[model samples]
Target chain A: MNVTEQRLPIIELGSLDELWFQVAGTRCNLTCSHCFISCSPHNDSFGFLSFAEVERRLLEAVEWGVKEFYFTGGEPFLNPELVAILERTLDFGPATVLTNGTVLKPEWLDRLRAAEQGSLYSLEFRVSIDGPTPELNDPIRGPRTFERALHGVELLVQFGFLPIITMARVWDESQDAEILGRFRAVLHLHGYDRPRLKVLPRLLLGAEAKRTCGYSASDRVTAEMLVGYDTTQLVCQHSRVITDRGIAVCPILIDSPDAILGHTLHDATRGFAVTHGACATCYQYGAICTNPSSRSPDAHVRTIDRT
Target chain B: MRLAFFGGIYNNHLALATAIADARSRGVDAMWCLGDLGAFGPHPDRTCELIRENNISVVQGNYDHSIGHGLNDCHCGYTDPRDNHFAQLSYDYTLAHTSDDHRAWMRSLPAQQRLEINGLRLLLCHGSPRRTNEFLWESTTNTQFLARLCDDFECDVILGTHTGLHWTRSSDTGSGVFFRPPSPIHQVKLNDGGLKKTPDPFAFINVGVLGRPENDGTTNVWYTLLRTGNDVRGGRSPLPWEVEFVPLAYDHEQLAREMQDERLPDEFIETILTGWWTTCLEVLPSKERTRGRW
Candidate 1:
């Protein structure tokens, strides 16, 4: 294997638990107000990872015992080689692609189904819908983005993909039950067999830094906290995510310079300080980086990394 | 009935003997066996064989059950698909690498053990009586706790050995729903002498598994010192027993490999490694049981 200079940043990365790829880098059709990376139609700070690059990492990860893969970006659906990447990753293990429901074409879904033909490990799609109603979602994700995303989700079901809808815990604790209830009911109308849901604690960074409040002085993860804490639950302990620029500590901190891991996974395996304000969230919530209940996944939707 | 209280005796026979000695020191009259008597270190068969030779009451847990049932899975209910893959592999490796006799012995054990202690009918289950495979930690629901208390075991007392928490709780108000001290869960009821005020309830105490890590991240195993303190109203408070874990070295890598092979879910493997998810599990202090604790 003739290797050249790597594209991944020198992350001093945490653990490389899974092999990851991004078809479309910082580019996204919808400019979600709360996007951690502030992805938008024009944001190209990161480029798409090539299929060849992803395949190379997949083979490399296998040697090191990495057995899972995830694909994400502004919207993974925006990538032209999205289906090809899924086709390749599933031969060895399961692959999950996170997407905003907008811009998903029915034909693309049919192609995805065709590629997933006899594979034992299924392809998972997670659709990010911020609110149960367009009123709640449109405010953050832009006008009518919620409806388009929901429409995209329906197409996925018609094509045999069970899309998991991810949400931020926007409603208060009192309205949580009702919020989730309305959310699930809407998903049911869309023909999803089991509507999976995820509620993320607000990461006051990136575009979200402006949506409400960014990290305050109190949000930082102090050194004293890690002394006796079981930091094992933090995703950075055992996993590093790969993006077009380089391997980063996790999908959440993709934009942070500190998260920019080395070009190669071998160089990425180093200690990281849970320094960022978001690290506090991970520390408080524990296991904030990995999926919540991806095992025995709901046959359609897959949710991970809930602290 | 002979219930042996064992704390951490992996492969080191010396530690095993020490646990036995500790149990005897407390004047305990029976033998008890917590699961994972094997896996994670060096010897799988020896650990199982030693427990068998001692004639300790063994209840096959998720690990023990997996190895015995020839399940290529650890079945710990882990959430990560990849980690689940790892656990399944560990399960397979344990099944293929371990001796056939060991596998059969692991399978032969039951979830619940029956015993008769001083005119008291008893049910001795490995983890919890309801699901032999479920790990009842501090985060375990009262419904789960109460259900395990009154479930199918028609015994007067329910003795479990999984979660290493050692507190004897009795239903003080309703039936028998006792809450112990600080499982890091808020709203825990005060552990006052409140059982006599209850309806009809027995006892649910984690005798503490004789093997594996304790709550403080230390390797010590835990057991209870039941003083049989007959309250003025007529009840017994299970006392805490101090017994050091005799660390045994078993094929942990092999067990991990087996879990990986069986593709047991990752959340469960992690739970087995680290006791229970403190976040998902809540502790709402002792409440009056809605049913009988028998």
Candidate 2:
């Protein structure tokens, strides 16, 4: 085959360790400028998954020995059936939900807290907030989202939930210490004294691509990159995303048409070619979507260069 | 066959001594130490001396690999800056104190061990079979993922320890609930090619470490004993086998004092004195973190 026909680096599914559900689909209450999928209140390209659909996938996941389950979308809370879905998922194993932390209700949190307490697994909430304050966060995430998300975080803490506050890196890398210090202080003031925080590398896709120049043509994972790399560091090696249409390779690639590999989890277990610009980001920051408990890929750790 | 497994000794020579004595007193047929022979404790040479003297079969942990090859860091893979700072302090201390001969021995250790005991293939690893430094916490790891490990590694039992917790999950395919949706939500049950029955059962055991207290507000650390063999009747035992987590108390005060004498971080001594982890808290899952005082 010629260079055009040659395959990109193909990463085989190490194991169906993480099973993700795009529960709310491509819709969000606050449309962040850096939204990888450009999810918004009106983006209906994809749709919410019903409780029955989620339940069915949960059953399928059990046989595959999936280690954990995750819920994502425009905002998982926007789906009316989300609370029920999470309640059901806790029964199977650990569950995690990625949200903008703007559309939560106390009653739902109460019921979910009870469900999590009753189960033998953990239910993790990852709330996305771009920056420490509105000044830095508002421009990326829409106006007024900072306070609303903070309120949502406060609600989570009230119900005995230690939600992990996730921030997309938007400023110079040198400013991380100051930004994180400010975030911790603010969170402490809001009653979250010991806040768990995660700073994620920005993915240059969707709205982000348009907002800040898209990826260069050379920003693609090449076959040579796999020579000594531990492929397991890449999410595509150990995770698959469930969408309304079908199962996709990973949460980061759902918007790519070729990402939908098959209708079932088993069929989707085939290798995925790292052919897109987002693949480079995934390579740079490994297993970016997995819960802290699941252990982030070692590729992200920057230590003294031993070799 | 009766066996004892130790996880992440972490240079706690005193604890390692006591646990070995206790296991030997209990009539264990064999003993194994699951790597991580150094770190977070004073006198790294002492633990190395004891393990070598006792003939403990070992697996190479991330720390062991790093120290053995003179790597810069312990490679515990902490993402938090504070956690990494403390980890580097411990790693540098350990590397500075460990003897060259011991590091060479660690370099010669295998990454994994496969043994057949009582007709069961038991695979011993410092972490998960696939990765040496992987953290397999009890609350976060599930049954199917373990079953897949068994299938891939082709073992009846896979034993690993790195998360500083001890737990066991039996993938006995015969257990009717092996692949069933958990009881609370079983409305949509489906048998998607459930586990097939085999002659023997499968299991995964995290033989808890002897390095430090499990952050359970107790000064006692744990080791695991696997009891497998025929019963008094000379036929196969009715329960097939048993997994027992043996917690042993040691003179942690002495260890803490020794650490202080060596000018080790107060944080390390605090964990010994209080039985609560002060450093390396970043890698802990929520369940484990919540259980700790710090």
Candidate 3:
């Protein structure tokens, strides 16, 4: 009962709605400056999850009535068994994977499309790009990373997959319309006539913390902030990430030691204390890592319509 | 016995009128509307009038609840800024035009309804039984989840229409257990000699909304007609109720003109005329979104 711990609000896992797997761990091809995990080929503090490991959790998730499964990391495809993992997941429920869109293979997409068609679920590919164009995106993700990612998008579209282009908001909020419009127009030029875009708020942590200003001391979710707040807005309320080491509270805070809740999914179901500055960002922007298909907290806003 | 289910009229009086006639022509014993009486289309009161005149049993949708209680937003639960802006515009138009009496009637409507037909228990709801505005997409929703909903609600069939798409999924895997007692625990005792392959008894149906055309490249809206049969399933032995998705073709030009006259966003008018969703596109799952013309 430290006073500091007493002040931090505890968020309970309402339900095991979304189960995440840090499949590739902190291993990525392009070390994006804004990457919260600072994932790079050289940085291997975290490791990839084996196909068997993911399968075990998929089976465990069924009993808990887990709604959906998500794969993320430095890059899930970096794991040799990523395709096999997704194919297995579709057997249980819908699966979504977060990748940099730079390293997708055609054979992988072909196999995934057949698997999705064969199963009663969907296999969603979420491709990440910082900005719409190379001039704007290269500065954050790396040189020529935009073209490579866009090429991946073209491949996905060729395989009849509607990839959701996930871009971290590195520019002003007002630039959203212009950026999205340009991205959509660009995608159309590359045969992705109908492009899906998700603009994510930048998280000031890990590599991003070094790239820009980290969260200030005042940027913490306090007990006072929980007053009449919809706790579901916080990912910890309905989700848990299964890292190579253990299950963490959320995908964003995997680097934090305190983020590790337990060794198993059941143990991870317990409440988590929102003490990190990243929690403040999660507080401001709900549904940070969830797929658009999954229900975001705001998806349930039922205020009567006086309009 | 046969019954017709209409989802989300969305103030499209033309579609509602045509769908009602179509349902009646099919000799449906009863017609039910799965709420969402207003928003999007023009003249909210006209759709309300059609509902009252047609004697369609209605359940409360998120839009109905919000409008009935005079809430600030339609509670459609859109996340994108562009989607919200268009949603707010539609809600404002619907609210300002709707009469207080209709709003009161909407407030009085039940959130969900249960009916028994030919020994089959059917639960009718706006979205899902768990929440009013939940989007239970076809590709994302699995058989296990639907079976769980059926078990929780204690119904053989659950019908909803919040996603504005028409699709049905039954536990047709032919291997998984279909019947489980309504309990929080997942552990359940299998019925009918335990290990015998039980027929897929539970069904989750999303009767496509009459509000607007589905994002499919067709200018026709859809509804659902469910018919009762012996064994809920007869010759098929496992297939319980027969579900039919009835597509209704309305005068798109007229609807578009009405929407335009109402000063609704041109985006909405574009949807009516083109059958492609131009706004509120963010809520659609990738599977549903990919099929659309954007």
Candidate 4:
């Protein structure tokens, strides 16, 4: 490690609270302009995780006391075993699947709905849509992709699944209220009245670096920046991503060579150096990758006088 | 030994009064409250008055901590904008209505309380034993994690109430299809609907809340009653402590009418009347949220 890298803050894995699987790997059907992984139809640098591989990780996660499981990919539905994978996951605990929402089918939804009902856990779907209108969303995502994703949302709602509509903030931060207002109105028009929305900060990596500007040298998370700060806000403190290559530090940094920590969950318990520019974004927006239900309460730690 | 545990009063004086009487009628030897005495209900002082008058032991909840120290938010751990908006309204109202003496008393309350009943060590807290505001939702929290909490805290039973839901997970019951053994190799045990035997069984119980309906479409609220028999064949009691979730019905309509009079948000009133949560929907895990009418 270099001098600056040596001085970076090392965050230990507090517990294996969340276990994520890169089910589809870096191969998405839609080439979104701001995809941090630069995933595309032809971008097959990584490979899909087979059903057996996912099951192995699930069993391993139980050993670690994993609280929840998440499935993501270029699109998780692109894999034929996606349905079975989620069906098996509910038997373990609550499962969430992150998808582009364009490739979902009725047959898959039917089985997932039944599985969720049978299990004691919940099955959540997070559908990615950039903005409220087609004009705003289509540019970042591909053309006509807005309407197709919206249909997917309607289908999920029809199957009694309330999908959390996740959006990457492409507009100015001040426009969040107005954009969310319009997004809620639009979702209400479609069947999702009580829409759950999550706004993600832009991760300046991969395709996003080429589309906009990459993080400058000053954007790194320094060791001084973490003093007295709740490091639990950082996803690396309590989570790990399982890819076909190995167990990565987190989902956002899977593309980085240094991100892959080990071949097994037990091997990946070592502390990680928060040196990447994306780590700065994660620091600013605490627990950005986790479901709202799973987010830690450490950010609100206030010193109260008991005397 | 018979003990009654109340969770999250939320300034609902009517429910608190009803619950206290119900427990008394059931011949409870001791009464304990899991804090959150103020929020989303009218007459914050009334709830405090009832607790003090009845001499109930209380552990500080996030809302109680915030109100005691005059913090900005309830620290309920809501991330959604809409949830925060409603939470702010409830906190402001509770802070303004709570008396200074009650706030001082709340400030003196402990974060967690430990006691031994019938040879069972019980740890009572507003949320998890580690954090005052941590949410231990049923669908998201796994058995091994619960076991770890019990082991770390050095308790056989961990009773918490923060997610406003009532549920229980026993170490021996095996929550998922797979049974987690001490060793990783023997993890996969297809749940045959029979409880697995464990040498040391721990239990984590979210003892429901008296603050509001559990988003289960019922106006009636819930509390927990833990009872242990006197028969002791071995070193421990012959039978384990039995947990019963007692649903108590109060005059919810009167509470709703009072809230409307105090100008509390209509959304808060809707939950009290309809028994379905109209706000704070974001913090719920999918399993809990799916069971509710938003």
- Superposed on all Cα atoms, the candidates' RMSDs to the truth, in angstroms, are 22.6, 4.4, 4.2, 5.1
Query: How well is each residue in A1-307 modelled by candidate 1, as lDDT tens digits?
Result: 2232232212233324455565688899988888878999999988888888888877656434343577888888677787787887766555678888788887777877876554534466777888789999998889988888888888887876666677876667567667877888988887764565656667778998987878766665555445555445566765777887888877788888978768887667776766677876666656543344322222112122334
Cα deviation at B135, candidate 2, in Å, is: 1.0
Angstrom error at residue A83, model 4? 1.0
Estimate, for each residue in B150-205, the C-alpha lDDT of model 2 and write its tens digit: 76677878889888889887754222224532221211242433435442367889
Candidate 2, residues A1-307, lDDT tens digits: the string is 6785465688888767889999999989888999989999999988999999999998888767788898999899999999999998877788889999998999999999898787767788899998889999999998899999999999998998888999999998899989999999999999987788888888889999999978788777878777777777788988999999999999988989989999987689889889888888777777678876676667343221112
DockQ ranking, best first: 4, 3, 2, 1
Clashing pairs in 4: none
| Window of ten residues with lowest summed lDDT in model 3 chain A | A298-307
Estimate, for each residue in B1-294, the C-alpha lDDT of model 1 and write its tens digit: 234555323333334555667667545667676565543333456666677787776766777777777765665544433345554554555566668887788788776667665566667675567555444433122322332244234445566654445444333321121232211111123254232233244555566654444433333445544432231123342322122223333333344454455554454344335533222211111111001010
Task: For residues A1-307, write the lDDT of model 4, one tens digit per residue.
Answer: 7997777799988767889999999889999999999999998977899999999888877666677899998888888899999999888888999998999999999999999898877798999999999999999999999999999999999998999999999999999999999999999999898888999989989999999999877776778778788888889998999999999999999989999999988788889998998988888778889998888445444321213
Interface RMSD of 2: 5.9
lDDT of 1 at B122: 65
The global Cα lDDT (0 to 1) of model 3 is: 0.84
State which candidate, 2 or 4, has the greater lDDT.
Answer: 4
Give the residue spans of candidate 1 off by over 4 A: A1-15, A295-307, B1-294
Strongest candidate by DockQ: 4
Q: What's the lDDT of the predicted structure labeled candidate 2? A: 0.84
Per-residue lDDT of A40-73 in model 3, one digit per residue for the tens?
A: 9988878999999998887776656677889999
Better of 3 and 4 by TM-score: 4
- Per-candidate iRMSD: 19.0, 5.9, 3.3, 2.9
